[model samples]
Target: MDSSKELIKTVDLLLEISSLLMVSGANTNRVNLSIDRFASALHCNTSCFISHKTIVMTVYEDNSTLSCTRVKNIPPYAINFSIISAISKASWTAVEEDWNIDQIAKEIEAIKKQKRYPKLVVLIAVSLAGAGFCNIFSGDYINMGVAFASTFIGLLIFQLTHREGYNVYLRIFSASLIASVLASLGIVFKLGANPETALATSILFLVPGVALINSFTDFLDNNIINGLVRYTTGLMTVLAIALGLFIAMLLFQ
Candidate 1:
């Protein structure tokens, strides 16, 4: 194939990889690095500006005015560490094997097809984590049970809303409100020694830990603009949770 077509292909591959990384919880630096690695393997040069919602990338060969540029809007954000890790591994493999565009594309498609844990398993594990948090806060078994139940129901609501393509913050708010309200029932029934702790802990599953952590990671890596964007997103998510919890408390009071 001609260099012009090859450059276009290279840019498309870079955008696809970068978009997957961005939406799958990778920090901006990692996305940049992965793009660089893929370009190196393809014998191309690239520059890109990545943001929370889009990537603008350019590709060309050395000493050539022939180039291609594209702007791709990123997909919705979600935490999928498996995709991040797999793509990072694939980037390295591309470098070591001196992969062509077709090979790398196949690898990426395979990574995308990876299976996630079952919904039932995820719900149970997350609920158990909430219960564990309640125990850490000095709650007894009864409070832990309350936490578990609330987390499970809340996560179920979140999954349903997510499947329906509702706005992300709305899904989080609905989940938090439902979970907190359910936890408050323990207080009303006097069912646990530390009912308040259960109520406080049940919504812990909705905390934007990955986003907040990635925000700080980007800041430390000198990706200030992306860091600030992620930080603001995390802040908004926290506010949504807080508002939901506040409404739940008002109901109980």
Candidate 2:
């Protein structure tokens, strides 16, 4: 009888965890199926306790009942439940408050509207200048200038295309192409003391390092389709930049 009681408590905890995950925009079908499997493991009947956007669970054991309604409110409950749900399931409880979904939505909207263009441009410029300095120390002063010019041109084109509400992929492609073209021009014109150094420095602006990192992370998290798509897109952007440089050099020569 005691073992049966423990089993019911375990099932309740699993259901509670599933509920919290659901509110946080996790895949609902996956969570629900997991909860159902947990309930089956304990040989207990389980049903999800749902509120406006919250989920709870009730468990029955030999005519006695255990309710996990202690963690209330989707966000806070998700945080708290994640912390303690790994221990003895009997201690799990839901709080008795509601999450303000509307307020959360408003906050997200405000964040999206914040000015990010100027900040991004400044960051890109600083990064390129740092790359330039590195090349300078390596005895490639011409490449340093090329790198700076390419980074600046990339930043400008990105800002213009983004402000015009072009597709994000298109903007990224355009910025990379412009940067590559500028660098190639330095090579063609024999600008500065070292064209090779300048071209190398300038090409830094066209690399999609962030996109590659994100794609790798997504792949590790089992989002293979999304990860592969993003990775391919980043690769294509790089190729587009290369293609632009090739075309520009051909025409100039």
Candidate 3:
């Protein structure tokens, strides 16, 4: 009974560590360090650590050790689920001496094999377009439609690049460029009513408002490094959009 209780406590510790690592966006090496620290904090002789640049975790216990390596590149959501499963298995092992880690791992494998979230990109695109439309000044249907279309195209570009696994920087650049070009075309050709207002609203989707907010939140949380990084990234995103628009105007003239 005491052994079972200890197992449950260890599992709880694992869950806490996993949650912290996930929130911090720690890489595999850092995750391992976190696990080690957590084990020390819990006064547990058992330790779990990950390999550098790999998703493999080596868990050392009193008399035995085990290694669990993810075979494929798992998404963040899947990783979260895996962490939960690991915690559950650890809890179960507390009550059962013959608990099969391999079987538990297989269960995690099965869960991962399930279809991932489809239409996530599509949803994000729709959200961007909607945001752009909302930012527009006019209430007329035609102006709104134009603004929505322009932003939709920009979002579509971002989604396409995202599907190809492009980095965040590239994705931001591509989205900004597309939005600027579309808005510029609308303005230069007089394609829509109140083109200036429409274009301004449409390009608002590419703004870094969320990033700035998060940066401030990070600062409030005393994460200076992360706050600065997020703030800089947000600034860069805004600048990229502005630069794209500027270039488009110069060429359109």
Candidate 4:
């Protein structure tokens, strides 16, 4: 294979890696570092830049040599730590050992397809987390149980809508609306000692806490634009949840 062509292929591969890392919830510095590290392993010079909706990467052997650039538009993806960790580890090893790109790509593909947790387990865990929120707020046992059940159903609705590829805001709004409305059932029927407790805790699953944390982390890392973008996105998510809750409250009131 010609040197230029092989280098271009490596550039394309790095582009894929960057997109995967970005969607998997890696911060800006980590994505750029991984791409540069992987490309350097293959003896190619690399530069990667990230923006709100786009990623651009370039590779060159020297200033005089033919350079290749790839640009990608990425939609947001759910955070999956298993995929992120797998790629980070693979990139580090590739940098250390200069591993074959094909093998690395295969590994990434396998990791991408793997599921770290069963859906049932995730539903149960999310339910427990919501119930935990009730406990944190000093709710009674009846309220905690209502939170548990409401969150379980809300998460189930979210999973279904998410799989259907609805718009992000719509998915969040629908999920919160369903959860809060159902949670209000405890209030209406007097099933729980505190109806307010169920409504409050049910929306815990929809909080944008992780996104806000990432936004602040990016700001600390000096990626101002990305930081602001993430913060704005998190804020919008919170608004969507609030709108959903407002609608539910109106209905149940």
- How well does each candidate superpose onto the true structure, as a TM-score? 0.97, 0.51, 0.55, 0.93
lDDT of 2: 0.54
Alpha carbon lDDT of each predicted model: 0.93, 0.54, 0.55, 0.85
Which ranges of candidate 1 are over 4 A from the true structure?
Answer: none
* lDDT by residue (tens digit), candidate 1, 1-253: 4878878877888899999999999999899999899999988888899999999999988887899999999988878999999998998999998988999989998998999999999999999999999999999999999999999999999999989999999999999999999999999999878899999999999999988999999999999999999999999999999999999999999
lDDT of 3 by residue, 1-253 (tens): 6555555545544544454344334433344444554454443544433221223333334553432222212233112344444544443443354334344444434543555345666545665565456444653555566667777787778768877987766677777667767766766777655766656676676677655875787677665765686688788888777776677667767
Over 1-253, each residue of candidate 2 has an lDDT whose tens digit, in order, gives: 7655565445445544565444333343345555554455444556665443455565554455543333334442111223223321311211112213233234333433434336566756655774565376572655676677677777678768766888755776677667767777877888766665555555455566655775687677675764675578679777766666566556656
Q: Which order, best to worst by TM-score?
A: 1, 4, 3, 2
Query: What's the residue-level lDDT of 12 in candidate 2?
Result: 42
The order of the candidates by lDDT, greatest first, is 1, 4, 3, 2
Model 4, 1-253: lDDT tens digits are: 4877777788778888888887878888888888777877777788778976898888888655688888888777678778788888888888887788787777778877887689999999999999999888888888989899889988898899888988988888988998999888888898756779889889989898767888898999999999999999999899999999999999989
Candidate of highest lDDT: 1
Model 2 clashes, total count:
11
lDDT measured at residue 214 in model 4 versus the true structure, 0 to 100:
81
List clash counts for every candidate, in order.
Answer: 0, 11, 0, 0
Best TM-score goes to which candidate? 1
Q: List candidate 4 stretches off by more than 4 Å.
A: none
